[model samples]
Target: MNKERNQNFKKKKIDAESSYYYALSHEIRRKIIKIIGDNEFTSFTHLKKELNVSTGTIYHHLETLSDLIEQKQNKKYYLKELGTYAYNSLKDNIETIKAPQNEFKSSFLNKMMMITSKRFIMFHKKDRIYTVLISLGIIILGTIFSILNGFTSFFLFFIEFNS
Candidate 1:
């Protein structure tokens, strides 16, 4: 009887682990875990607003995440122990998860623009001076190019007028 009980317990544990990973498999479910974990508690309406998905979609993902999350009497959802674990894991490995795949080649200008935009959007305090200097350099170069182009056009007009 004790051996049978132990087998049952092991089976349930395996099921729980599978369910937890299954919940993490979907993007929406991961987002839900992050939202709830970050907020400690959140409402269905808040999730819907943040996700901007159809009601049915939210319902489906929430159902899948049932093992990870729980609702309180006040109708707010919060991460369960498993949910918290998932959230921490997700947070820790988010960079790896979001790393861009080299599926397509981008032009040098495109890569530069993306790098500059990302730096502008996510720079740290230590990078502030570097970012500002790079931005100023770009602006100065643009202004110089514009002025030179204007002079070139004026010189061409002057020559054409004389001709």
Candidate 2:
């Protein structure tokens, strides 16, 4: 019975730790942590202002982080020892999550490729036939004109030679 209770307690702690890490993975959460670290204390309003996030979003993230840090007074939050340790452990990984340059490039490329693919698909069978017909008509007209002009020049030379 004691062993089972200890196991449950450890499992809860691990779950909390995982949740804390997942929350901290977000860029906004990292900014919040930095802001909290700088101020040492912060309210929801100030956090929303500084982070430029919706009040609900800020509060949700704060609540998640607070749960990891442990709730103390009502409407107030602080990072406890576990929270501090989690933040420190995640510091390096958090820095990489900021701005996401690679993700932006990939998204841009995907959009470009989608647009190009649509344009290629827009070339219907009629359009293809029209292009081929136009090209063939131009070639035939040029060939006929060239042959007629060549015959006229040859006939003129023959008349001059005979005269």
Candidate 3:
């Protein structure tokens, strides 16, 4: 049980880390974070000019990064603590990645993982809690029955040998 709990904790941590990266994997979002991270505050207009994206596109990226950024009273955006950490982490990590020999392999693996995770989540949601309980009950009953049968066989062998 203790081991299972540890595994679950590790799994949760991995899921959260992977989800964070997945959210930030977009080109526009990464640029927005980089721009906001370097400066004290950036207005929507500056981001629009830097990214050369439409106002709506900038707003969408902002919405995606809402957790990391906060709007000031003057309507400029600044990174929260989380945003700063994310920016620095991205900068450090992305700088280390080199062009892979197997670009197709990397993309294929990512797509496969995405599809498998989606299907797994759907199946997990649909699985009933009672099914697990019922399986445990069946295993327990089977074990008890097997032990009783073994005792009966031993008793019969002793009685016949004594006679």
Candidate 4:
């Protein structure tokens, strides 16, 4: 009987340890526990808003963490035995999630896009006129030069034939 009781106690301790390990293994779950530790019994809406994670992701982590954490009567949460263990496990490494402000990187990218768009528009507008003028000039000059050269050659041939 003494041996059986000892075995049962060991099993229960192992189960609790395993649950703590599982909860603390994920970064998101660890962060969740830290948030809950600081403010016990927060709503799901608050977690979703603060963490900036999707509903599905929050729900999954919360479900896994619920086993470790304690829940209040109002479906709020507190630190159960396993939760306290997990919270302490990740206390030092818990990271706070903050939303990034619309900063220089995005503004710079938008400016670059605007500049490129304007340059392309200007090039398209001017390119047609430039191309037509160049083509017409080349055609006119070529025709005039060819006619002059032909007349000179014909006059030289006539003079030689008469001689």
Top candidate (TM-score):
1
Candidate 1 clash figure, as a count = 0
User: Candidate 3 versus the native: TM-score?
Assistant: 0.48
Please, what are the lDDT tens digits per residue for candidate 2 over residues 23-130? 678888877776666566667777778888788897687776765454457655567776666667667566787747564467777678544545445667767775
Ranking by lDDT: 1, 3, 4, 2
For each of the candidates, give the backbone clash count: 0, 0, 0, 1
Candidate 3 weakest lDDT stretch, 10 residues: 154-163
lDDT of 3 by residue, 28-132 (tens): 888888898888689988998999988888888788787678899999999887778888987887665643534437777768754453434445544546445
User: Who is ahead in lDDT, 2 or 4?
Assistant: 4
**lDDT of candidate 1 over 51-137, digit per residue (tens):** 999999999999888889998899999888899999999998876666555322567756675566775878889889988988898
Candidate 3 CA-lDDT value:
0.74
TM-score of 4: 0.52
Q: What is the TM-score of each candidate against the true structure?
A: 0.58, 0.48, 0.48, 0.52
Candidate 2 segments whose C-alpha is farther than 4 A from its true place: 70-75, 90-163
Whole-model lDDT, model 2 = 0.67
Cα-based lDDT at residue 3, candidate 2: 100
Task: Name the runs in model 3 displaced over 4 angstroms.
Answer: 1-19, 98-163
The lDDT for every candidate, in the order shown, is: 0.84, 0.67, 0.74, 0.70
